[model samples]
Target: MTDEAGSAGALTATAGGGRWPDLREVPFKPRAPWFNGDLQTIRNFLVVEGLGRGPAPPASRRMELPLNDGTGDRLLADYSQGEEGRGLIVLIHGLSGCSASAYMKASAAAFDAAGYSTLRLNLRGAGPSAGLSSDCYHSGRTEDLANALRTLQDQDDRIFQRGLCLVGYSLGGNMLLKFLAEYAGDFPVTAAATVCAPIDLAAASRWFDRRRNRIYQRRLLNWMLRDAVRLPLSSTQRDAIMAARTVYGFDEVFTAPRFGFESADDYYAKSSARRFLSGIETPSLLVEAQDDPWVPTASYDNVDWSVLPRLHRLSAEGGGHVGFHDNASRVPWHDRRILSFFEWVAG
Candidate 1:
């Protein structure tokens, strides 16, 4: 089918009250050999690069947005001008991930192929932005996002008319939710979506550190330490992050102290998106797997969905963390779901 026809199908797929796909009619069935959560989660690493990715994004140019915080910290993004009228999508990556992340590239390519211009944002010190910012990026660093949007708005007024959509993965998802809530009505955001975001920081940290999840925890912590050392920091700060054994420990020693929180617990409590969901006024989508390894299901359950009328929760019975490899297609399920939701909103 043509792209335009597909977009229309997606736009009409949403049920009343804005729920997409109506699960009873379109449930996610994981592909063979990846039917379970663990297998689904690891499949990305094992699969060949570009196996199912869409066409290469049209020629792109780099854009650096300086944070307004006066620290001289700047964020990097790859902007690709797509066919006009399709609008723009800003994609944020998960913990220790960047614009080059497999998921980010795949999603950007998919959206660009669908005619939407795309920007893959590398959070402070991530990807090409390493050592560009002395200050650290935490879940509540909405100001950086605000600065980026304002700068873009000033440069191109078309964003306001064509509309802007934000899509975040994992930790970035948490940050996006907070930004949507804390900065509601401040920007002309047409829609937003999060994939496997740990909305409750404290809960996710606890679950991640569990013995069953030690493998994933260790790898992520190592990436964090490696990236942290590249930034300009005092020896004391360097030592704290390097010596850390777990994600929580790393946060306690570096992220919390450096960001002015009393402790890791305080940092988690203050930075978690769960506290700000009620304030989100934009049409937002939250996608999570019931059997996610790192983020416990309770973290998602804790939110009182009834209070947030604008939020659409898609708690799939399977798909793992950021791994929604359905039997019907090679592309991850959430990508199609999100693109559809965006079409509906922009329609």
Candidate 2:
């Protein structure tokens, strides 16, 4: 948690297979809490600031990539034009988030500023495409993601020539990590980064069930449930869904079976990236906050960094789930950290 001791040491000691340049010299100061140090107050401030007014990017071009679902639902990828650039950076959003989400927009702007082409992937049934598919996307779904990456790669063989970078937020991060692990040598990704990911889905579900996490739990669960109810399912599926009491129960009842998994445990076991961290071959960065209310540090602790030498786990003391606002100006600490890590990796 202390940046003074250097993160590189922790990364090196933990990571065994991948080689990383010594970043011990990278000076980083942990941000202090605002609003009398009350996490709730900090959370409220960030929710308003991040989702509220902010700088906007230039006009974006929207394109739909055809899928084989026979549902006529094509994947939406938004491109924010920038000065001619070499590499392409694909941004994936968290649960219930779309290409239009605030964080995704902000990241697209950042990538454009860095002279990189940006593509914001809207997961099936996320944004405008919600009505296109009766089936919803779950955290464990990786086939669409793999297909998207391949589509991008095929669209531009230049992707392999320049480089490909993936930036996934929260649930999207979990998906990205799982995708990388599943297609370690098959993909052409040069680097990837996951921000505030709930690595251990099972732990996260239990954590959200706690009294303090109730508000967040209800918000996410309601969103997911609303989506599930919209899906055209058999009477048995509807019965199972209607009988669910909590988000975990709903996921176990609906998501698990739909995804070909036995239950929540099977889904979690198959989806969690911690088990696959040792197998990641691409240069990657996993950033989590010690105080992330939704994703606890314990979930991150399950990661064995020593096996996959190319991965760096960055744990900051104060960023709230994707809300890494710093100082009175509300500048995002996570964004700067992400840029720095990517620059380091690219260089």
Candidate 3:
């Protein structure tokens, strides 16, 4: 009913999570016939993975960005060639996701069709980047995203037509916004877009572990655990990974302690993007699904929109996380929505 600052300092429309809003008012429409949030999510995932991957990007090459952290850590990023002057887009993935994730590939394909160059990044140690770092990637690893930006700027340092777009999904979205906010004016970024980002990590964590949501939570954890075992972790970190049954356990035993956090709550508070929304000045498109499994509405509701007139918020009625399906086609509608946002920001 009321969206105000809470203990979590969350700006939420509804206390628990959210209510079903009208689809007509939403930025994008769900595929015809089916509006069920669950079905929308499932079909989005199935279709994207099964049939709708779209055409693969041509002349794509995987390049490693040197972290220069003295640990010899290098993050992986894949580049797809596009027409020059159209701009370069750096794509970031969510928790337990990589550049090769179905959504990332589909979106890259769309960008390629538009003659835009794209980079699909593997944050630090997710996906094939699992063993690349001794430290694990958390929700607020803005440092990693910053490193990627600097690397890109070094390669394509030009002021003629600054058309770089920072695109992120889920946890990656949170990190992208935080990086732009904290390091404003330091990076020459033209635009940004985030889909289904968990701005408030604490609220999201609670919602994620809820009984009915266990299936999704378990799925993410399993993927994370697979990545955890491969890294060169300390005794505490390894033990934490071994004992983690869910994300909370993983954060408590590994993420918090490893990342210099006092506890999981501390990690969530400092790492959440909700606190930094007011500080963000970048032209960004923030998309959220009314029925997204974990990302809470409080994050979107609590944002100080007046301070971010350039920041467009699109709360879709049935996108289901990042699952914005075009229904008849395998390509997700989010691809175009993101590209449209980038184009508008570029102009």
Candidate 4:
């Protein structure tokens, strides 16, 4: 809570010749029956994703981006055009999530409604593009994102004038932050946002290992294991991945070795977004629930926000990992809040 950038005063700071909207003032009361952190988190799975919850986005045009790396790995994305004047918003999904994820679709619908075209990207070996890549995506795969951006720019000339905005969920958010920091002046990215990101990968992994988070950990691990086994990995790697019980174990056995890390600890240390946060010069918003079931608040607490002037954060008391269901509005709280941030930056 030190430096608390979401405070009223901090929210009004000048940017792009105008004052930024105070998104913190927009309250997020947990909806009926989903009051506590656990309830909020659980509600996400219980509710159907795109079954008449809101206006479904227009059918998206599928685009495939081949990674610049010699590996011939390709990533797929669904692009839907909106009011062109507003610009483009690229949405990145979390671990085990795809372009078809509930949150991604909801957020895309919200952005499309607000006049920004949206692209829902599937990282390496995720979603519909699971078979397109032999290598899996790690938290530090900024180069892949860079390649995607370059491809997008080449495909659409408007991006050069209107600029680009990015929104990432969970692990995807960590990748966005690292990309912004590491490739600061590379892309024509105007603004960015991260929801429920584990900036400190090591800390988040330890939290996931906790007994209270066992169920969530098991589900995520199973999804990952299933997807990894489908890849063209060796039988030994497949057996090792299946033998892993926890997320940390999976990372230690599979992720670390495949990504060229000496070990899980080394991978987490090198790939964590925390180390790159201070280097971020782009305007960005970070949304986190203190009671997030997986990402520990202690990781957010350890950061010195004073150095990250460009990163606006909202560390809510409760919303439960990516589940910011608001009582007052049918639209998700984060969708509304992030749109406001993008508007401010686009101004």
The top-ranked prediction according to TM-score is 4
CA lDDT of every candidate: 0.81, 0.72, 0.74, 0.83
Off by over 4 Å in 3: 1-27, 32-34, 50-55, 156-162, 328-330
> What is the C-alpha lDDT profile of model 1 across 76-139, one tens digit per residue?
8999988877788999999999888877877887788778899999988887988577755777
Question: How does candidate 1 score on lDDT?
Answer: 0.81
**In candidate 4, which residue pairs get closer than 3 Å at backbone N, Cα or C atoms, i.e. clash?**
none
Candidate 2, residue 295: how far the Cα is off, in Å = 0.7
Give RMSD to native, each candidate: 2.8, 4.2, 7.6, 4.2
Worst 10 residues of 2 by lDDT: 1-10
Q: Look at candidate 1 and give me any clashing residue pairs.
A: none
Model 2 per-residue lDDT tens digits across residues 1-347: 12222233333344575555444344233345442223522453355445566436446888677566566666888976555545777899998788877777766766676667788998887876576666677886887887767776667666556667888999999888888888746776878999888888889888767887667667777777777777788899988887877788888898898989998888988888777766677888887877777787898887666656778888776666776655522335566556656665766
Can you rank all candidates by lDDT, best first?
Answer: 4, 1, 3, 2
Clashes of each: 0, 4, 2, 0
Error of 2 at 115 (Å): 1.7
Candidate 2 vs candidate 4, lDDT winner: 4
- On residues 156-251, what C-alpha lDDT tens digit does candidate 3 reach at each position? 666215477888898999998888788856776788889998989999999788898777777778888888787877787677688888899888
Which candidate should be chosen as best, given lDDT against the real structure?
Answer: 4
What TM-score does model 4 achieve against the real structure?
0.92
Indicate the worst ten consecutive residues by lDDT in candidate 3: 1-10
Q: Assess the local accuracy of residue 142 in candidate 3 as a C-alpha lDDT between 0 and 100.
A: 83
